[model samples]
Target: MKRKLLFGERMLLGDGTEAFNAVIPFRLRGIFKEEDIQHALGQIQAKHPWLRAIITHDENNIPWFEVPGNHLPIPIRTVMRKGENDWQEESAKEWQTLFNYEEKPLIRFIWIKGEELSDMLFVFHHCLCDGGSAMAFLYEFLQILDHPSAEIGVESPILGIQDVVPAEILNNRRQKLKAKFIGRLAATAIKCIPVSKKAIERKNDYLIHWKFDKETSSELISYCKSQEVTVNTFLSAAVLHAFKKVRGNAAFNKVSCPVDIRRFAPQIKDDHIFAFGLMIVVSANYKINFAENLYAMQEAVERKTAKLNPYITMMVMESAHDALKNFTKLLKHGKSSNDCMFSNLGRIQIPHQYKEFTLDTIFSPSVIGPLGNTTTLVTSTFRGEMDFSFMGSEGYLPYSEALAIRDEVIETVKLQLDPIAVL
Candidate 1:
């Protein structure tokens, strides 16, 4: 049976942000079979329902969703063919240009026929699935390609607005009163402060791409263990170091980190849900030693992570509806508190083998938008290495600055290991 799309799903579908992109490139040993590729694409579309859905708008500028039957899958385009050395360089540019998103299916497949091997690149928007979902979709695609009769599983459907929280409840008088009071408080706070001129002028237009070698990744993990801190804590500190150097502010130390509130309450863990989860604002005052400051930052993060309550985040989001209305004014006035965002998905586990295809490295590009450009540093450990994806707006922050921030992070880590040798 065809299912209806949820509000969150529709929001992503209608929004043209590149946040929902999943770029998967596969290297094949041999190719030249059109039928096999078509069959694989069919299976993929059948398994993932988002590919079949379309976005529509009403008179109010709000987005609505619809699905088509027996929808044709977007065909794979042949992009470029380059020799060994030029493959990566040529492929990156070609793939980015070809895979740009559209309001429709927004899925693209590219086949680059090389001398000894063939490369297949699959790009899909994030509205369809996240990292975990993308991995599952890729597995299904490969399985269908190798084995035609394979049974592909569909994702658990998103809950309609009425099913999870009734629309009437949102309009309840008591809830309205609470929202009003919270909104007033948020507005008053905004009026009391001035926005940072530097933050407003510094547009984030940069893209950061970095991968840690196995040895360096191991060392980082070991260091975290020895310090008795979570990998996120250590990573967050490293990010702060990068930001400090770029901003050149000794007192600039504030980070907002998203904490998944699922496990906080056992009852809600199994409920497949999507919304902004727990968010904690952390700050570190500039002090003497770098290591000591990091330790303090780690403690602050750990404490907040431990004490976060899901209900609190829900209440804050609900009550802050009024605050969202004046977000632009608050940001312009420099009342905005968070300098950056650190999101850690921790580790992603996929099966070692999926029928005929073996698992490869997974990359996740960080995403931030709608609000003032805030730097978001996303990290996910897969297979044995860490993949860091940094994403922000080109308007508020430049992409070149973001890349420089990443370089500073790696250099700082290296310095931590050999402080005496440098002198």
Candidate 2:
């Protein structure tokens, strides 16, 4: 199976040089056999063609995902577990390590072997899949690892843009004209936008990890429910408030949030391997108090979310292929306007207890890319506890400042939890 890379895929793939990878680190409590791991991976690879495919460029130098007659199996590198922090160190190394896309698949696994407890990290090129896709992969892997004969269904992959946008919408002449006009206009504007000839110096990339105890997490959830706002909205407000409090005038007051395309496009299934997703920019109104800002931000989020049209957005982006170079240049050299991107994966549904092994914990996934700001905050609740992974570059956001911001976010949430009922 083969298909030309979509615009969004190409942008995330880059020139196939630097690493734009995502990692999902998790701990499991059991004795895992090598054969069991190999069997599970083979099943998964067989189920998802893209997981076993490699990237190859054609005449015009456009990348295509091609499944070869004899593609290599997904490689697993096992390292002795030195301590609890070994997975973190390995994850950092994986971030800087470039995938050999020409020969191997775009995904790999790192096994931190230990006596009783083991930590595993699933690393993928950002071009191959999104967080939603990765989590689905994880859930399946566990299911199969326990029972090698597990029946995970095959994926009817997305072949092109047509798969996502309906035929009726694609055939609409008015929509076609609008998409073309907007695309060309965007391309022209990007060319005219002033940007630094040199890229922003990303120095000393770092990750700061934290977690909220079950009690605190519960209280926060209760508070958000009481306010009639989502936990995501409340956390976004807290993050923005933290930056404004710590950085003062330097804060951007904006946070970029990725809207899962599956939510809008039913054609894009949870099992489908897709990289493209819709995005929304969120910001707080400083004129209002923190609680007021949460309500206001929630309203803004809902309004912007309601306005999203994945079909039109994809059409516009696909029309702007010629602008890829200029658009990438702007992202590489343009001034940073947002404080950071905040992603809340919400509650993970994967069971922690399995027949053979006990799933200990699922950490909040971390991702780093060369595009735009490297500062990002990701959170997800697993086992009734909320975990956070704050990743940033010292050049983009100093380690000291990032540390302070983490503390501030926690404090801000704790303050809001004061009024919530314990029961």
Candidate 3:
């Protein structure tokens, strides 16, 4: 079985030179068997067809998820845990590890084994899965690992664009004409735009992670509720504020946050391994007080979110498939518009306690690609504690300044919960 790559997926698989990987790293304490880990992966691959599929290009060089009669198991690479930051070092390396898309599944696993505690990293090609779907895979792996007999129902994986966009819409004559016209216009416009003459040299990417205790996490949630704003908006406000303070006036006041398409498209369930994303860019109004800024950001988030039409966005992109190369170039070579990409995987629901082993910590997922800007802040609350993984490159953001921005973000959050402390 073969299906054409989506527009977003095509952009990710561009030239396959740079690593476009996403990783979910977590710590577990107890005895683990290598065979058991392998077995769990087998079960997951059996249920989700994409986990067993490889990318193959046609005569036109278009990528497709080609399923062979007999698929090979996803490969696993294991390393011995040396220190507290072993996973961090491995994560950095994983960002440089490109997927062999033509041969193996677009994902791999890295195990940092220790006597008492072990860290497991699930690394996937960004084109293969998003954060939510990755979390689903993690949850299922834990379930089957803890109990070999556990059943994870098979996923009727999305085959192609038809699965995501309803058949009725695709069949509508008017919609078809509109999509074709837009696609042609976008492609022509893309051809007319000038490509960057200067090549931006690639830089070594880094990941920094930290977490807030349960008390602090709870305080943040309560504070956001008291202020009538969502945690996402509050974090966006803090991130913009942090960049402005640390980078001085040169920082862009805008921050882009991705909205899970699952929220709007019922066709793509939580279990489906899909990678199309819709984003809303929120800008901070520094002229207002911090409290007022939060509210203003909340309003912006709500208004933009309401205006988002995932169906239309998908249709437009599908139409602009020919312009995808230009789109990828535009993203990687164009000037950086947003200060940073802030993603909040609000309140992870995976179970922490298993029958045999206990999950100690789930570091928020971090992904860095060879794409243009490297500044990103990803957050998640797991086991009652809020965790963060900040990834950036010195070329884009100096390590010293990134550290200051991280500290400023924490301080900014605290100031909201405790206003008097700011003085």
Candidate 4:
């Protein structure tokens, strides 16, 4: 099926910035041979249409997808080498490792076969897909690997935003008014804040990861339940506290949290479209105790988020696409005081048994946005454990400090429930 890309995805392609690129690595075990991996690639090519697509430009200079033919290789490239330092050396390459490809949406595969288990890294431009789509592709690829005789599933067609919104609906006066209001609010919010000094200095440079075992993960879930708050609320509150501690600012405030639009709108579920949805920013200004502050933060986030869901933002954006895009570029280049971005995928459900292999820990590197010197935290829960990974521009913030802040967040949450307990 042929479908247009989402507005956000289209914008990413238009800007042509490396910040929007996505890399998803899957650590696999119990693999037999190289041909087994090769066969999996063949099955993936047959199942996904994007794999065989090439980027073509229209008269307007906008890029769009075009299918070359059935013979097009699934955009998969293999790099096989023998030596201990090979994997270590290649992994250290630049985050946005460019591949020599004629197509706009380039998909490349890097395979490193070690002594016992093999590692597969899938890199693709964000213009084509998001983390969720990448994970779906990985899951399917694993399925094909487990059962080579299994029939490859039919490809899912891409559905564009224009197709989802009819022309008549786009012309509605009420929708137009709503879009105008949202755009004005977004613009005002951007103008009211001062650009973060750290962002201005361009000192962000460290990236670190912290994981919680099953026991600690369970404790966190229980703490949230007892506190009558969602996991995100608890985590966000903890992050605020940690920032206050490290920054030594009692007046700490402003956080950008990503809200997924897939469930907010049925039309957004189409696998082909890309959407950033609404950024829920929680303001910190009132004076209160640590626990009360957390509660206030939770309430602020929930209230702001309820005003307009992801669908509303998408509609607003669709109506004022050009204006919003221009405004966003200006904000990025100017001194804007947007503190950080926190994204929670909540929990991921992988099948207990994929063919015959057992699913293990899934780690996702944070996708940096166009704005420099921003802190992004992405969390995913799997197998009763929650994994939080932090990523930011390496020159503006120290990774070691950010990691310590993450641990402090986790520890503070644990202490709230069990003060005597060790996390």
Q: With candidate 2 superimposed using the best TM-score fit, by how many Å does residue 103's alpha carbon deviate from the native?
A: 0.6
TM-score, every prediction: 0.71, 0.98, 0.97, 0.82
- C-alpha lDDT values of all predictions: 0.58, 0.92, 0.88, 0.61
Which residue runs does candidate 4 get wrong by more than 4 Å? Answer: 1-6, 17-19, 74-94, 99-105, 149-152, 166-168, 171-173, 176-206, 250-252, 270-273, 284-286, 309-312, 352-356, 419-423
Worst 10 residues of 4 by lDDT: 85-94
Give one digit per residue, the lDDT tens place, for model 1 in 1-423. Answer: 334333334434434533444455445554447677778887877765555555555575444444555585766767556753232333344323422333456566666666546666666554454433455566567778778888876645443433333345555677567756765676688666656545455343444667787777777777677777778777777777778778675325777777765557443322232332457776655565667766787788778778875543344344553444355445443534455788777776654455554444555433433345456777877777887867665654566667778898899777765633344
What is the Cα-based lDDT of residue 293 in candidate 4?
66
Candidate 2's C-alpha runs over 4 A off are: 421-423
lDDT for position 205 in model 2:
88
lDDT of 4: 0.61
Which is the leading candidate under lDDT?
2
lDDT of 2: 0.92
Compared to the true structure, candidate 4 yields what TM-score?
0.82
Q: Which one wins by lDDT: 3 or 4?
A: 3
Runs of candidate 3 exceeding 4 Å displacement:
419-423
Predicted structure with the largest TM-score when compared to the true one: 2
User: Tens digit of lDDT per residue, candidate 2, span 1-423?
Assistant: 899888999999999778999999999999998889988888899889999989999999999998888957889999999998998898889999999999999999999999989999999999999999999999999999998999999998888899999999998999999999999999999999999989989988888999999989988888889899999999999999999999999999999999998899999999899999899999988897998998889999999999999999999999998899899989989999999999999899999999999999999999999998999999999999999999999889999999999999998987787656433
Give lDDT for model 3.
Answer: 0.88
Q: Clash number for model 4?
A: 12
